[model samples]
Target: MQTKKYTRLMLASTLVLAAHAGWASDEGTLTMGTSVNYSSGKYGTQTSTDITSIPLNVAYDKGPWTFKVSVPYIRITGPSDVVVGVGKTSATTSTVRTASGLGDVVTAATYNFYNNAEAQFGADVTGKIKFGTADSAKGLGTGENDYSVILDVYKKVNQLTFFGGIGYTALGSSAAIPLRNVFSLTAGSVFKMDEKNNAGFAYDYRQKSSATSAAQSELTAFYVHKFDKSWKTQTYLLKGFSDGSPDWGAGVSVGYAF
Candidate 1:
């Protein structure tokens, strides 16, 4: 599933990580990373809202199984009606407000069903849960949990890798904030520039969580560089074509594996 800022990075990173973490490795690998992301948009409003997020992520991969978690601290300067993760709701206001605090916590587990080294084909299934740790009073989140299941597949041809996935999410709802279950899709390709670098572009789409909000559609271009066997970095720029997404966004992250 897709949200904004930090969530966007997680989705893209998952694809790249899966591509790099081949199924041949029987030993476990631990990875940790952090990133700073920023996005701004009107969300069909007269006044623009800006959001900044810093997320800490950790993941472990062993054989066919992968486990991951992410937590974010967010700062929002916008209308009180705008909600983090879900974006603008039915409520509207011209008054702008600023709030800062913890955002949502996300966790997931993935299992690789098949991988063919010679054929360069692989498939996986992932189950994800999003905990509403952010403060609802501050508009950081909806104060409820969300669940998702995704099926992803990839094919490698020479130095290029193509990947895509489809997912369904069950969003929790409350009296103050009603939400609907939605479906999401993502497709992308990564081109290996050399032994140490790669670049790619991905597109994400999700149905609207609320009747009033627009569907989410975004395009992101990313670059990944390996500093060494245990260290790596990633940078990305995002452009949104739908009212449900941020107008523009960017982020940088560094990760270590051991």
Candidate 2:
């Protein structure tokens, strides 16, 4: 395959897995987070569109299990005919306040077959519900429920931490369950700025169940900042590869831990 061939292939694969990617810990605990996601691309002859959203997440964790629900109240937009604030498209976004109600719900449990606060090995099962509005025309939801199972591993070397997960989705017949099974590999490291601040970079590779499956990659940078004994904020920016959307986005939220 040519170079561009690989890029385009990767893009298609990423978009397929894009609708839901929980990037981190699944073990049940309690934490809250929020972020803004935006992306633009082409669907056909017409220039695709730009979407912006505010996603809110509430999660609970107990030992080696975790469950989370993300809600995104979003505005659909078409290509802009003008430019406004932040050099953003001038196109007027639709007034349709669609909801991803529990749309991106995820539940995971880890057994920690072996973990030393620096390294961990376990298996996880994830279930996603499609209760959100799926106006394929708007590219918001997949319109079906999806199931996945993965074996995960994590390691920490000083300030450098690495995490990798490999799994396969049932790929059952569902509007949301992708036509083909899926696979993922992820690695990330954290840098401590102090007792209250940490920053890091992450890289991810995802593919389908078949040999024809293209590998999609992502690059992300984020910060975890603590303001007080109980208040903190975690923020990150994720960019997809090739033709995949969500190519450019950022999010930040304040949270409290008890």
Candidate 3:
């Protein structure tokens, strides 16, 4: 069953790539990126737990639509008490558990419903799917699929852009943990420092997945530098404000567009 699931995911990804490659034009752009991230502290536990993940992303944009897909490989080193989804464990064992494998396959499609080039404002809706590609036995994922929908709006004024969004996610349930549907909100602004440099900050809040768990909140600052018309690099730092999130995290990514 696992083999079949992976095979289907790969096939779907390949088909999307092929379709985009054939349809790409001057009006459309394709971008590829890779990122690595590390974070420590599980839930509210003072335990020394950490997670590392490396993800590969592909995105395509054309006209008023955008499509994205991501595949991640992740490693978790910590006590098994750190339950997935709930983000907390009651066990006090000093023995750490390590798990590594493909994490999850995510795909999204966005359609711009409104745009005003002269006014520099636009709104879009995105639908996303999270496939359970990770090995459940390895504790990489919950072996269940999730879905979400988000609405985003942005406006540009001079060199600064303001954006915000809200979304609802239908969390998948596993034998080990039961999750509830959650709502999330994000708000931020970005400033273009020059032709090649940009900086932004965002705050995110999410409802708790379980009644016993606290809601999650985080703040992130990001910077992007364009190496050329076709290449760019991005880096970010994150600080979590709730037990359901990592205490601190950082990552860097390089992207190429064509």
Best by lDDT: 1
What TM-score would every model get versus the actual structure? 0.95, 0.65, 0.86
Model 1: per-residue Cα lDDT at residue 11: 55
| Count: clashes, candidate 1 | 0
- Candidate 3, residues 1-258: lDDT per residue as tens digits? 011122222222222221221233548989888887777665756575677777787888786677888888878877666644346534345456898888888898877777777777777788988887877666676677889898877777887877878889898886565678888887777878987887887777788876545687777787778899899887777788888777787777777988
User: lDDT value for candidate 1?
Assistant: 0.81
Cα error, residue 257 of model 2, in Å, equals 2.1
Top-scoring candidate (TM-score)? 1
What is the descending lDDT order? 1, 3, 2
> Which model, 2 or 3, shows the larger lDDT?
3
- Model 1 scores worst on lDDT over the 10 consecutive residues at 1-10
Query: Candidate 1 residues 1-258, lDDT tens each?
Result: 134544554454455444653662688889898888888887777777788888898988788888888888989998787788787777656578999998899888888888888788888888989899999888888999999998988888888888888899999899888999999888888888998998888888899998667788888888889999899888888899888888988888888999
What ranges in model 1 sit over 4 Å off? 5-21
Backbone steric clashes in candidate 2, count:
10
Comparison by lDDT, 1 against 3, better one? 1
With candidate 3 superimposed using the best TM-score fit, by how many Å does residue 33's alpha carbon deviate from the native?
1.4
